[model samples]
Target: IGGGSTHAWCQVYLPGAGWVEFDPTNGIIGNRDLIRVAVARDPNQAIPLSGTYAGSPDDDLGMKVQVNVICEAVAGDSMGASAS
Candidate 1:
C-alpha cells in the first residue's frame, strides 16, 4: 500500500437491509477497492502489528504496505496496464 492507507471501519446494521458497508474514504456505497486480507468480529480484534520486525516486538521494527497498479503501458515492457 505505497500511498494507500490502512483503516478499521465499522459496518452499519439495518433492520431490514441487514449488514451494510460504506467506505468513507472514497464515498462509495459498497466495497470496491477494499482489500480484505483478514476478517474478524470487530476492528479491535483486527489491528495486530504485522510485517517485518527485528529481534522482538519491543525492538525496532519496520512495516511497509505497497499498493501499486501499473496504470500505463511501457514502450518495451510487456507487463500490461492496470485499471483503477
Candidate 2:
C-alpha cells in the first residue's frame, strides 16, 4: 500500500506477550489495520496474486487489482501507535 502495491507485515512471538504483529510498510505495531489472510515462514508461500489465464497471447491485455483498506478506532488500545 505504500508504493502502490500489496503490503506485507510480520509477526513475532514474545516470551510473555505472545505473538506481536508488525507492519514495516506503515510502521504499525498492531493488527488494528491488518487482516490475517495467510501465515507462512517464507514470503513466497503467501502469494498475494495468482491465477491461470486461458486465451490467445495477443488477446491477453493483463490484469489489475485495486485494494481498499478501512480502519476503525479501538477504545483503550495504545498498541496501534506506530512503532519507532
Candidate 3:
C-alpha cells in the first residue's frame, strides 16, 4: 500500500490486462494504494460515503471522518522493494 490523499478514480477493462485503474485527479496509472470500495457502470451508483442521521437540529454537532491507509511488510520481504 501507499499513502496519499483521498480522491476519486475509475477503472477500465483492457483486452489482455483485464481491469486497470486510472486516477484522473492525480494523473496516475495503475494506482498502488487505491482500494476498490464499490463497482458500478455509472458514477452515481458508486458512492464513497453516505448516511442519514435522525436527531434534533440543536443536538446535531455534525460529523468528522478521517481515513488512513497503512502498509505492512510481508514476511521475508524487504520494505523498500516492490512486489511483483
Candidate closest to the true structure, highest TM-score: 2
Candidate 3 runs further than 4 Å off: 1-6, 13-18, 50-84
Compared with the true structure, what per-residue lDDT tens digits does model 1 show for residues 1-84?
A: 221567654568879988877767666455666765557896666875546445865764445766565467669886765666
lDDT of each: 0.62, 0.74, 0.69
Q: In angstroms, give how far residue 54 of model 2 lies from its true place.
A: 21
Candidate 1 weakest lDDT stretch, 10 residues: 1-10
Q: Can you give the lDDT of residue 60 in candidate 1?
A: 42
Stretches of candidate 2 exceeding 4 Å from the true structure: 1-5, 50-84
Sorted by lDDT, highest first, which candidate order results?
A: 2, 3, 1
Please give the lDDT score at residue 83 for candidate 2. 86
Cα lDDT of model 3 by residue, 37-76, tens digit: 5678877688775667788877845445465766788899
- Maximum-lDDT candidate: 2
Residue 67 deviation, candidate 3, in Å? 8.6
**Winner on lDDT (1 vs 2):** 2
Residues forming the 10-long window of minimal summed lDDT in candidate 3: 1-10
**Can you give the TM-score per candidate against the true fold?**
0.42, 0.50, 0.43
